[model samples]
Target chain A: MSELIRDFARLPQTWFETPIAAIALTLAAYFVGVRLFKLMRHPSWFPPVVIAALLIAAVIALLPIGVEDYNRGAAWLTLLLGPATVALAVPLYQQLPQIRALWRPILMTLPLSATLAACYALLIAWAMGAPPEVLASLAPKSVTSPIALSLTEELGGSTALLMGALMVTGITAIFGVEWLSRWLKIRDPRLIGLALGINGHALGTVRAFEISHQAGAFASLGMSLTGAFTAVVLPVVWHLFV
Target chain B: MSIMRGLLWLLAFLLLGQSMVQLLPIPLPAGVVGMLLLTLWFVRRGKMNADVVAVSHPLIAMLALLIMPGVVEIFFVAGRYADQAGAILTALLVGTLLSVASSLWLMRRYMPPLNETDHE
Candidate 1:
């Protein structure tokens, strides 16, 4: 078995062998997450991302597996991100007519939402005594993954750490969004999903899908707009604070 | 058309990623720059290819799950923040809450109802 494993690792095929394990783990995590999510009545409190993270963390700790091995398979999973992001256009296109009707409100609110969120981050960081790197990393949490990772590295934060934190934040929001809405008695799926995506980031977007199509569309739009708004404004805010 | 459109957006997102790493003048994260670029494109074009959107949506979804591999790194940071956990955690909790609350409020105020036309 050890010799077989060695030979398979040595195979000239990085693609097939490397990502297979990660894919399997991811699928396992997904299956578990789905069950838990369903059992929980699909509330936002049971965010799949967070559950998956915790589960994966536990598995790695107990199994004696290396990240390199995990990543060998995980890397293939990363390839799906670009295509999945592109898929967001489908719901957006369907919602186009409604989006157009509500254009004024969206245009007016999105920037303000972005600014307020960034400002809050700045304020909290200022109050918290967080180091510069943490501040920089926290600054871009609302954006998508690829962009968020790049910003983390650029801003002198640990890209890996920031990525992890962003994932946590997104997942927490995704899981919590519905519960928050129900607790608050907020019924608008569009508002709930958009708010989650904007504040929760990618994790929120995933949660958005679990709800309804209209809600998912709004979440995607919010995610995109917030990213743009924060990209333009976060640095400016950082310059002022840091 | 489908393949070309997907490729274009993919290349564009990739370029945006590059720009975040390079062209952006801010002290912000590069990934944020790419996101900003994508958002700008959507805003300007007012439409994106359905195929492209389909392709990109899942990647973002997967990102949430992808974070598990980095837990070892988080354990390392836990030490650094340990001394300041009381403060930092407070700040994180507060900041995150405030950001979410305000963002939702503003989004609700500014965003037109979803049932409205897409041209807005």
Candidate 2:
């Protein structure tokens, strides 16, 4: 078994050289992860994204391929992020009447929540003795991945570390939001969705959709507005304070 | 075909958003600006087309998967920060929970009560 494992690892790198190989590997891993998630009854214990990422990570770790190579091959999928983000407006538009009615509250909540997200991350990380870069990365963890990555870049933080922090933040919001809402007696779908979107970003939006259309609409609204507010404000704040 | 049209709309808005970001003085993300632009267009039109809904549903559903590549980079990069992993994790957990709790608390306190017809 050890010899076989060594032989597999020593296989020619040419087989995995093409971008197709990378894309195929990602899709296969993600599908398998989704199957496992469903087989496990879709428990919050292992979200498909976490499973897929781990599987891909394991494969990349064992293979004789560099991170840059893998990322370059997978660039096509990442490029869709921008269009997908714009696609979010469909749901937001559906909920516009309600949003317009509550525009005052949402406008007020956006900056306040954005500030809280940045401050809580910075202060907690600072107290924990996190280095400056880690603190900067954490400051934008609550925003969507695309915007978060951009914010991290602007603030001179490590994009990879910010990605990890985001995964943690997203998973926590996915599993914890409901329990927290019940505990806090948050009954409104709008507020519940808003909390999840503000804290979890895209992952939280996915979970919010599972609850109801109304919840999903509000979640998209929260996610979009928070991303806008954070993207515009975080770099300036980071420069001034951190 | 309708999905294609819907995609075209998304792509167009994305381009417009990118142009706006480059032209405007404020530092805004193109994606968010595109979303806002689409929202305003939808508001002015007074209805959402089914084609946009058709395309957006699948896109949003698979949103998490689309971000996996970036997340996977963490595995490659996390080793450098191994010493600080515990601190990072602690901050993430505490900060996330606090942010969610505080946002929910504030929104509930300040937002007006929902109308009877709003329960949908």
Candidate 3:
């Protein structure tokens, strides 16, 4: 009986070491987050992604699993992000007219804002004496993951650090935009979405969807424009200086 | 199902993007190139591509879920960089706040009100 019970206890350990467990844990955490967000009446502070992360952290604390186990198996999830990011074209396409009509302001807003966001973080981090690697990672923090990620690698920043910074940027933008817009008495979804998309990147776009579809559409536009702008500009500048 | 068809179409675009990145000296990633290619393709047609839409809708709908793992990794990473944590946190917060505020102001200044354009 002791032998049989011990074998049964070890089964979960073996399974948790596999990729299936990692992927399954992620999906389960996310769905649980979704339900909880709804239960809490869709508060920004309790957004699904952050809640999901917390849930996964809880799993780590409760079980024998380490983040490495999940990291090893969960790389496939990162691959899926590439194609999903490409699908953003759908929203960009859907918002064509608004994009076409507001071309001037968007053209104006993107270059300056994208440059401002990147420069401010880089300057602050540098001034505060962050190591060069940290500064490099911070360089692309404002751009969406897919684009910023490639830049991060090219710039020799840590992917893990960039991922953390990217999340912080998005979550911060989501909370900050809501609060700032309210304080300034700004009501335009277009304006709010631009702020979110430009500052938050994809995460901001995700949050904007919760506000309204109009906001969602504009946010996607903001994200794509910012991504493209940074993709072109950052590398040339980096190569020139380095 | 149409879902598979949509994914296949996206894959082709992704592949094209991958190849372009290889052949050219562009700074853009394959996936972003893929997105821009599809967007330009749709622009020429001047409409949404139904096939892409089939996959995109579900993907976009679950985007938060898709992004969760990356965010989850933050838990593990936050501690490793604890030394620079304050600088990193302050920069992200202040930078994001200033960026958003300035961007919003610029949009409001340059563009007219929401009703002024066919934004929806």
lDDT of 3 by residue, A43-160 (tens): 8755788888899977876777677777777777767777887898887777777777888878887899899989888878888989878988889988888788888998988888
Listed in order, each prediction's TM-score against the native is 0.75, 0.92, 0.92
How displaced is residue A146 in candidate 2, in Å? 1.7
**Residue pairs with clashing backbones, model 2:** none
Assign candidate 2 its CAPRI class. medium
- Order of models, best TM-score first: 3, 2, 1
**Candidate 2 lDDT tens digits, A133-194:** 78878888889887888788888889888888889999887767887889987788888888
lDDT of each: 0.64, 0.83, 0.84
* lDDT (Cα, tens digit) per residue for candidate 2, span B17-120: 99998998746678878988998898888888777778898888878778888888888778899998888888888877888888888898788877843663
What's model 1's TM-score? Answer: 0.75
Best by DockQ: 2
Per-residue error (Å), model 3, residue A106: 0.9
Angstrom error of the Cα, residue B114, model 2: value is 3.7
Error of 1 at A38 (Å): 3.0
Specify the poorest-scoring 10-residue window by lDDT in model 1 chain B.
Answer: B27-36
Q: What is every candidate's C-alpha DockQ against the true complex, given to 2 decimals?
A: 0.31, 0.68, 0.67
lDDT of 3 at A225: 78
lDDT per residue for candidate 1 within B29-80, as digits (tens), equals 4344444456557667777656566556555456555544444345434666
Best of the candidates, TM-score: 3
